[model samples]
Target: MNIKIPLPASGGLLLSYKCTAACRHCMYACSAKWKADWISEEDLVNILSQLAGKILPSPYGPDNIGLSHGLHFTGGEPFLNFELLCNALEIASGFDIPSVFVETNCFWCTNDETTREKLLTLRGKGLKGIMISVNPFYLEYVPFERTERAVRIGTELFGYNAIVYQVEYYRRFKALGIQDKVSFDKYLQLENRTDFARNTEFFIMGRAPYRLTEELADLYPRYPAGSLVHMPCSPPFLRDWHNHFDNYGNFIPGFCGGITLGDCRELNDLLKNGIDLEEYPVLAYLIQDDMLGLLQFTVDRGYMVNGDGYYSKCHLCVDLRKHLNAVDGFKELKPDGFYSNLA
Candidate 1:
């Protein structure tokens, strides 16, 4: 049983929410216009049950289940699915699973008592961490007050476990801020090394696709593609971005009938129907085989740079980003127990 998430990173669950704010460059285009589906409390919980290491096939032993780290939740805004989100946290807490984290745009977080209470709710769920996306591009759509409120709630709720990521991708790229690009000479001497800038291809997520013009695509090549990098691609995350239900529980995105390649509901169906995500070829490359050959492959192929060398890390597919954006890039790719028996 080759049961494993291809990338060596944490097992993540992506839940897309429909937001009131619609930005120009949205990657998944998670907004009122480009709405994806929201997973239900029932389905999301069921999946967690599977991840608790019981339902899913376990190539390694049971201890490997709890030994795994990092259960990340990202989306249009996790807060949009407050009820289900809460369910997930509380369940993870019940299981004593650590690293229950979520990434958000801070739009729904507010000074309202309900919001404070919700943040407080996560505390009970082993919510050891939270990442706030503070991209400058959101300045036009997201109110700073919302982010400020989220930060306050985060610190009060998750305490020292909160992290914030830079969101001003367009401006940074527009300014050509390639500080990481300056380290070319140090690692290139090794003939096979992976760094943040080496093989990175620039991928625009969250509001970028709509705003991306022909002129920008032309400009994308000017950036550097670092070398020898391996990271998670978009299989899992893409699989999970679905439609948000009405306050009543109806997925409003798309026809709610069609299925995208990586959407969660469809993935679930695939599972029930006997298709295993672990068996996907692309997934196998990143998550299996001790996680080193992939890194070396990236190094050998000169893909360690962000976007095939021309774009930023965000531009790559989600799974691709997971593998590349891993802490320390190549080195962070770990060899889980599942690969211990490999030759």
Candidate 2:
């Protein structure tokens, strides 16, 4: 069956790369050592303005005819810059966007009273939902008590429906012995599991491949050789439900996490009219699920692989992009900091 890729209805703005806690599994490799400034107020306003004028693709039809759709604010730690976060939410609220959400690790929830006050401040501005990151990786830096406090406060302020707990799959499996068909279901059925509990799979990219893979090798599952090439990337292509804009205004397709489609600041048209994936060299390869083809394409273009084996397909893909950027000046493929941890 031929599956059609839908255009994006949601947009995510990455406020900054600076983070207080450096989690091993972070896909963006965000850490305190990673120096980058927050998205300026002017840029934030411009991005939100563009999002407000966007028309939802035909797949969504007339139901969303003249409405501002989904908008999410995320970062290494959004709450780290409280003032900027509040400002961005206020701007988004001005657009009357339907879903204005924020993703955070809840590290700032030092106490229930303070947390409640902060949540109230955000809610008053325009924040609709809070997606909390919960797992062993985050627990190392952010105490479970802090996350619990935030969740309790969030439930009280935003209601259970508006609160989301993003639990990592591997951590849940490792900690609770949740694996395979029956055990996974058992984990979901646990008494503590709420309706808003969302199980997220870890991508073997960025910090995960370098920092966490070896220690958890036994628990990690391996794909059959060549399976990755045939595996479809749903979020960036199949569903095409969302795109992430970095602090610099680069539009990153969610599936190909590293590559940038275009700089929204340079291409204001992208804000009015969304990116066309087919035109991008890297994204076009991903849309077709042609990993091997991409590697070969890069090789033909004079790119070379650094290692004999990779932790996963994403590892290989990132390496290839790094080589392309270093040797051929494909700077738009990925941020230079993505290769910083590489030896």
The 0-to-1 C-alpha lDDT of every candidate, in the order given, reads 0.44, 0.65
Q: How far off is residue 281 in model 2, in Å?
A: 3.9
**TM-score (C-alpha) between model 1 and the true structure:** 0.50
Tens digit of lDDT per residue, candidate 2, span 257-292?
567766755445643455565556666676667888
- TM-scores of all models? 0.50, 0.77
lDDT of 1 by residue, 198-250 (tens): 33333454334225423245444533333223434333332222222222122
Candidate 2 positional error at 22, Å: 1.9
CA RMSD per model (angstroms): 13.8, 7.1
Least accurate 10 contiguous residues by lDDT in model 1: 334-343
